[model samples]
Target chain A: MEKIKSIIEVKNLNKSFGSNHVLRDFSMEVVPGESLVILGKSGSGKSVLIKCIINLIVPDSGEIYVLGQNIRELDQDQMDKLRAEVGFLFQSNALYDSMTVRQNLEFPLRRHWTKEMRDLNAQSAVKEALEDVGLGHTIDMMPAELSGGMRKRIALARTLILKPKVILYDEPTTGLDPITAREISELMLQVQEKYKASSIIISHDMNCIRMTSDRVIMLIDGRNYISDTYENLQNVPDPKVREFFD
Target chain B: MIHLIKIDSEFLREVGEIARFTGRFFSEVIKPKQEWEEFINQCFWIGFKTLTLVGITAFIMGLVMTIQSRPTLLEFGAVSMLPAMVSVSLVREIAPVITALICAGKIGSGIGAELGSMRVTEQIDAMEVSGTNPFKYLVVSRVLASTLMVPLLSSLAIAISLYGGYLGVNIRGNVSWHLYWLQSFGALGYGDFIPSLIKTFFFGFAIGIVGCYKGYNSKKGTEGVGRSATSAVIVASLVVFIIDLIAVQVTDLLGLT
Candidate 1:
């Protein structure tokens, strides 16, 4: 991968729920237009790491910069502004089950987008994102009505509507069938390529890691098992790292 | 003896947990960016959804109270004062408090279980990772909604309950609708109504906060959701009564009676 300007900078991050320390002195940098796949076990704090950067879970102590904005220092209004620039694909599709696909996609855009932007254009953006994820026709359906794969696809579409500069995926393919997972990984790659947006995907799926990653790193034991390529990661002697692939 | 002591200890611990949870809710109320939407939704759910139930309950409560109190008033040859007594009782005390108690059961458990499941299932985490402020979106909205909505619901309940009392008065006596309302309002002053109305806000706040706290801080997965929901209603109901007692004492002390 070619070197690019850093889009997200995380430094000396530490978090604890009471005494159960989750992320300890973790640090990583993501470059503009890079697709960095984070590989970690369930409790290795993969979700927490991305959550901290996105200002979902504030770190007890650390510095986080997303697209050049220091998250910890930013106020609520600033954080809301920063959120509009970042998109997240939650692990469970978090599609507001009560709402239809069109409504789900419209939620963030409606809340954050200005009034001058036509509502029809917003709907079109949703349609385009859904079309990009191959769910263009399913927009009228509710999340509960969709299959697991379709739900994930709609979730991905919702993430796209914001036209975010930094997109985060939390276990994007955990529950999908192999074929569906592959399609999603492929879709993610397409998103990165098409939008030229930086993506940080948190997944334990080896195929997902290999297929979508321009750079891959493993979150292990509260620290990052930093590796630039999927090929280099096999050299990691840690049993957890080996088990991660096996 | 030892076994009995262990049972007593466990019961005490349960009570302690309830108190601590209730205290935490009060602590969090002043926090900012309260989820206004969730609160509004709760108001809609608790107050609006339960409208028919509250109306019927209040009506029956009033009817029953008037009928129940009529015998005593008649024994004293004060049967003519039945309308005035029922009105004051229903509006000033029974209506707001009873309406809130019902709300605590319905709204408190609903919020507790819903949020607890969300916590267990990681949907709340999903909200966070998506750059959505979970506290502001979930807690703030819900608590604010309950706080504002419960008072409004109580007002509705009070009115319905007075009407029920009227129906009860007319069941035997020839009290007209205007006469009943006038006598009810005459017996009830700002002193009676304000204290009771004020307590519903506390009741709403209690339900919202306890429910959210339990849900937000749920544990043990599926089973935890049930435990939190059940405990929320129980604790919130108890808190409503306790607050009502305090409000009564304070109002009486101030000679607002």
Candidate 2:
């Protein structure tokens, strides 16, 4: 048995929107190269937790450490720099509608890579990322022209172009058909293995969670209610844990 | 009374937010990370693409003002006063404000809807998460474009309007193009040109600022996009009038009017 390094640690996070308390004393840790799924129904604060980890939404009270630096202590510049290492796939795909797929893929490189570097390697990087998602030919098409499955793949390709150490997927399979969902699930597995990337997937899709997540955390009532392997968690007789399996 | 208070509070909150948003724009715009490419593209869109609309509106306005004012001046046997009256009114007030109003409808709504759709669709978020400055790329470019274009548009508008008044003068009367030009130019003073031009920059700023704020702070889902676009035009239109009033007052105090 080998020891695994902790890539992300979230402890005692509390968030509220006026009267609506979203996350309460929620805590979790994600080890390096692991797939951890946060499963919650609508409005259960699963998305909020992922946002907090990425420094998008600040929690009312919490300690979040990413790659050993306390997120709260990082300045805006530091947070922005850290963002390049942590890829986030928004549920809506968020492909730049005004830009073509190649341009969208080039966006991060333009920001993070120097002009010379981008000029020299951007084309190759875009091609490789597109190839990773199996959509190499759709590079020049607009986001509007792409099918949902294709758009999602483009977004994944965009995220992968940066070769982010940790990928945060927010409802990656939410709006897809069952077949598409299964394909996306398989892609997530492939991404994990290929990139050797630690990932925090925020999802409610049973098939997605079952296939992609190595460990699942049930988020209910604004808390991390249960955390275990998929098969082991199914055996738990507790009603709260059983609710997910049943 | 309670409703009134609520409205007042909401207004104050929005004002505060706009101020903060403006501050953020300034900070990002000055930083080494600049979006000159996007800014130039926006300048072309906001300035060049808007030329036809502004020209048509300005032409109609100059002609209509000449026609409408002719009756009153004619009663006093002051038919020759037509060009001077229309010219002064158009250059000093009408052209700038009318063009601004048109921009409030056209540019303001366009920017609002574009950014609103981006916000709702999470393109803005994607930019941020990818470590790109959305404000710098989106807001600074558009605002700078509007601020620069308004004055140029107003100047173009004034020229076209004078031409329009010239055509109106010839419709029922014989005034040479030379005399019409002399009268129109003679009527415009340093006072009229400077004050009117300055105020338009503010109008441009107002339109750009209000539109961006509405769209950037839009709520979630499809309906939020509509709300963002509508509120952008409404608030921008209102702010144009308010800015015009303030500009007039300031010029009056300085004896520029």
lDDT of each: 0.83, 0.91
Candidate 1 lDDT for residue B17: 72
Model 2 per-residue lDDT tens digits across residues A1-246: 445368899999999999999999999999998899998789999988998998878899989999777999998789888898999999999999989999999999877899999999999999999999999999899999999999999999999999999999999999999999999999989989999999999998889999998899999999999899988898999988787778
Estimate, for each residue in B178-254, the C-alpha lDDT of model 1 and write its tens digit. Answer: 88878888887888788878888888888888888878889999999999999889988988889888988898899
Give the least accurate 10-residue stretch of model 2 chain A, judged by summed lDDT. A1-10
- Please state the CAPRI-style docking class of candidate 1: acceptable
Q: Please name the candidate that would achieve the greatest lDDT relative to the true structure.
A: 2
Chain B TM-scores across candidates: 0.88, 0.97
DockQ of 2: 0.80
Residue B154's lDDT in candidate 2: 96
- Alpha-carbon TM-score of each model against the true structure: 0.85, 0.97
**Candidate 1: clashing pairs of residues:** B34-B140, B34-B141, B35-B140, B35-B141, B36-B141, B38-B141, B38-B142, B39-B141, B39-B142, B39-B145
lDDT of 2 by residue, B178-257 (tens): 99989878877899999999999999998999889888888877799888888899999999999999988998999986
